[model samples]
Target: MDKIIIDTAQFQRTISRISHQIIEKHASFDDVVLVGIKRRGAEIAEMLQKRIFELANINLPLMALDITFYRDDLNQANADPIYAGVDNPIPIENKKVILIDDVLFTGRTIRAALDALLDRGRASKIELVIFIDRGHRELPIRADYVGKNIPTSRSETIQVRTEHYDGINQVALLQ
Candidate 1:
């Protein structure tokens, strides 16, 4: 079941729409912080931040969160932990946090991120924003804002690529 549903232009448009919706729902970017999970999630978060800044002229804080060590699947005997460097050390306590991720397949990653965040400090509220929501969630997690909801089989994979890294923006379905 190989399919290329979302093209570059469509992907960009979807992202733009999501950004606008985020700004609208929040009323403003004030006190909002965009925190992206490592790898592609970080890139998506940065792109969203750029759009928000351009649209509202409000520069929201962008933070990177690396949960490599926090993942429940990784074991010390099988893999060595790698930290994807996060730039900000500002405490998230009492701040509105928006967790960004490229794809939401299993809910485990979000759980790990929440754990890591709690270790640092408490957030006033945490809302999830995902570019692609491929359903097969192991936990009860759901996205507050979703770019697209793609029904998928367990064997399928949803890939999200951004212009910042891949020189193009698109979402591809691979088996």
Candidate 2:
């Protein structure tokens, strides 16, 4: 069973606060790019773009990434890594990339994402934004912007429910 931690209202507040922080950090959106990890992460990035546009009236380019091929411990038993690349509509070269993800745990996923991103183009800067940071890092990666940090043991898990997938925005703790 999963215990609900952050509710929908709280999730919205977290996103709104993060959007403000984004605006405060960047002088302009012209040189900034939002790259979201597939599925939940992509949806959250879209929300961030909308929130930023709603607040500053500046629409930033958003890109979705699938990093399956870039994984170090990739199980290629079922799928081919070469065919795992997602469609990148915009170029990230010379732009400040804001890498978005739903959770940050082993940091391996982020390392894979970085590999996938660099394949597209060289970004001037790459900053991470994680909705939940569950702390069990196998690498030195960290999120520059985080919505919430929930420490968990190896036996526990954090599940982020989003509107598109779960019909609601909720963070749950599973033990």
Candidate 3:
């Protein structure tokens, strides 16, 4: 069964709130860049980027990251070796990087993203931002900015769909 957790309006408001919080914390967007994990994360990053642009009138650098090989559980047997749509080599040195993603669960994906990000460039500070944070972290990683925190069991799954990718704007909890 799938149950809706967030509607379109709520999702937009969440993104807006997150944008305002980021601006409030950073105070300036001059040295901040948004780097999103590939797929859904990229969509959310773009949304946040546009929101920030509308609010602060600053066009922050945005980059999409693919961490295929960085994943630890992937098998090399039948998997494709090629990683498509990789990063464009954005300079993150001495900059604040806000990593965006759809959901934060086990923290493995974030770990892989961190490794992939480090391979590109070193940032002065790296913070995580997630639309949904479900609480079953295997690592110590935590989101600096969270849209919603839903305590979920290990068996449940959280899905965040955006119009940019999933053809809808909603968040759902699935069992």
TM-scores vs. true structure, each candidate: 0.93, 0.94, 0.94
**Residue 42 alpha-carbon offset, candidate 2, angstroms:** 0.5
Candidate 2 vs candidate 3: the TM-score winner is 3
- Candidate 1: clashing pairs of residues: none
Per-model lDDT: 0.86, 0.91, 0.91
Tens-digit lDDT string for candidate 3 (20-106): 999899977778989989889988999999999999887889999998889887784486666865666588888899999999999
Q: Write the per-residue lDDT of candidate 1 for residues 43-79, one digit (tens) a residue.
A: 8888889888888887889888898888898884466
lDDT for each residue of candidate 2 in 1-175, tens digit (9 for 90 to 100): 8999999999999999999999999887779999999879999999999999999998998888988778887784576555434655689899899999999999988999999889999999999999999999999999999999999998998999999999999999999
Q: Which ten residues in a row have the lowest lDDT in candidate 2?
A: 76-85
**After TM-score superposition, what is the CA distance of residue 3 in candidate 1 from its true location, in Å?**
3.0
Best by TM-score: 3
Off by over 4 Å in 2: 76-84
lDDT over C-alpha atoms for residue 12 of model 2: 92
TM-score of 3: 0.94
Candidate structures ordered by TM-score, highest first? 3, 2, 1
